[model samples]
Target: MSDSKYAFEPAQFKVICVPGDGRCLFRSVAHGACLRLGKPSPSENLQKELADELRAKVADELVKRRKDTEWFLEGDFDTYVQQIRKPHVWGGEPELLMASHVLQMPITVFMRDHKSGSLLTIAEYGQDYGREDPIRVLYHGFGHYDALDFHPSGAKSKLFQK
Candidate 1:
């Protein structure tokens, strides 16, 4: 991973790369969810399965919250939900929001700022759940996302330091 002026020290966090299948976002979230739960990382096959399950749950959550979400989504909300249910479909901010609601946990998205040459928090979801330990994901500034985990030694990220 490239150095980031705003990132935690390389030793503080490890970036776990997931398959680049269109489901990268969901896979990353699933992987992070495992870490958050104090479980070992799931196998690649398990991750894919978890991603699919999460996708389904997210679709359901979207339908359940259509009144509050339809305004921001593009095109027909029903169509969006159907499209997202497919395994190859890629998810973005809307899906992430729904995932947070589905899992009832906070999710934090980070990205490298090209201009500042630093990693930065770009978006967050599920703040109502709490902020103590969010499911951390690093967006590659494109369409890809990877999970972030602190070292087992318990070193904290400087980005979160006071």
Candidate 2:
């Protein structure tokens, strides 16, 4: 694959296959960084709702693709979510971070278990691109291993880590 294939193109969509179990690596388009529909609120529920919307968009894509492969959402938990929302609060401000010309669109899939909010893959669809966007695809296949030890397939690193 060429570099452009991995690079971001507004017209193109990127697919990241995050593994739920060790077996199937589910896929979802790497939508641009998460942005609040309104000002940030002090409610965790609000954040969760926003995340759900984003994840729903990804899920909707999965359904349209009809690939029948399980996909997942990956992120650094709430810490990262807040960080992205208000990067200035942390050392790496958003302006500076964006100045670097790369965006770390950290996303967490909204569907999750009642206990652990860690990475998860659920069934649903939310976004519709109308069949035109650059596409990025990833896959994971490790069915025999236990869930605790399972990992995403292919390169074991992040997609856009600077």
Candidate 3:
């Protein structure tokens, strides 16, 4: 908040707004993953690539675990699998769950709190079982998704500033 440590380095908290063009969720996930992986200011192309990779990876895992399909998809697992691989489709909490499972990481969503002028922890995606030393991603979730970042500097991050 106003502390020198926070002022000089803000890696523990940050934000990134993704395009609200229906592809925000995937873009958010991709960017978040990249940030977690230590790639500061990951490119749009790289985010898309990461999202697509996660989609395919999660989809395949679902297909293999037939029993898990009933919880995530509606009618057909095959159809769901194909759709998730597409760039245009949006992902939701279900996708996040699968992504966390596939990657074995924790995804923390920081929702904007207009009243409090701070973020509210809506949900975290790695509570299933136990995972030690997990990579973490911060997300902004409204009706859409946005990737959040942290900067270890006093100034704001140019790549993620509003």
Candidate 4:
């Protein structure tokens, strides 16, 4: 196996549906995260609406599967993880940090296969402006971390979703 590198990279996401719903089905194939919905592009405010709807759906789905609720929880969780979890809470321009709050949900990380699109890679660790080393926040903590480390790979190897 190849060694995983801990560095900043743009995360990717794929929209999918929940299993029984003929129409309410969305999956983030890249990340193995699945979702179920009732409509296709259901609302006029598509982007924001989907984020809100998916936020709840993703949380429910993660909970049902005994997965950490990090992927599903949004808003405060994102801010807390991106900002406070790492020992160093103030890294770069404060203005850039503001943009992080704008996202309604956690961005799924993806690794593209040779065939075509990207596959989801569970984000076990994240970078913060204040800390020199990446922080491996606990998914169960909703982005909270108890310690700081400088390992190349953020979290323990066993943490990936699948």
* Predicted structure with the largest TM-score when compared to the true one: 1
Candidate 1's displacement at residue 38, Å, is: 0.2
Q: Which stretches in model 1 have alpha-carbon errors above 4 Å?
A: 1-7, 114-117, 152-162
Candidate 4: C-alpha RMSD to true structure equals 16.8
Whole-model lDDT, candidate 3? Answer: 0.62
TM-score-best of 1 and 2: 1
For candidate 3, write residues 42-146 as lDDT tens digits. Answer: 677776666667777777767776686566577677787788777677777777777777866676555555564445556667755354423333444446777
lDDT of 1 by residue, 1-162 (tens): 113233533445677889989999999999999999999999999999999999999999999999999999999999999999999988999999998899989988887656754457778789898887889888986789888886635465443221
Residue 16 lDDT, candidate 3, scale 0-100: 70
Residues 1-162 of candidate 4: C-alpha lDDT, one tens digit per residue:
113423322122212222221112121211121111212333323533443344344334433433343444444655644442232232121211122222222222223343442232334222333223221221111221111111234344332322
Better of 1 and 3 by TM-score: 1
Query: Which parts of model 3 are misplaced by more than 4 Å?
Result: 1-12, 128-142, 151-161
Give model 2 RMSD, 1 decimal: 17.4
Candidates in order, TM-scores: namely: 0.86, 0.22, 0.71, 0.22
Q: Lowest summed lDDT over 10 consecutive residues: which window, candidate 4?
A: 21-30
Q: Could you tally the backbone clashes for each prediction?
A: 0, 15, 0, 17
Model 3 — TM-score against the truth?
A: 0.71
lDDT score at residue 12, model 4, on the 0-100 scale: 21
- Candidate 2 C-alpha lDDT tens digits along 57-142: 43344344333322222343334344434312211112222211222222222222335423233211222322221122222222
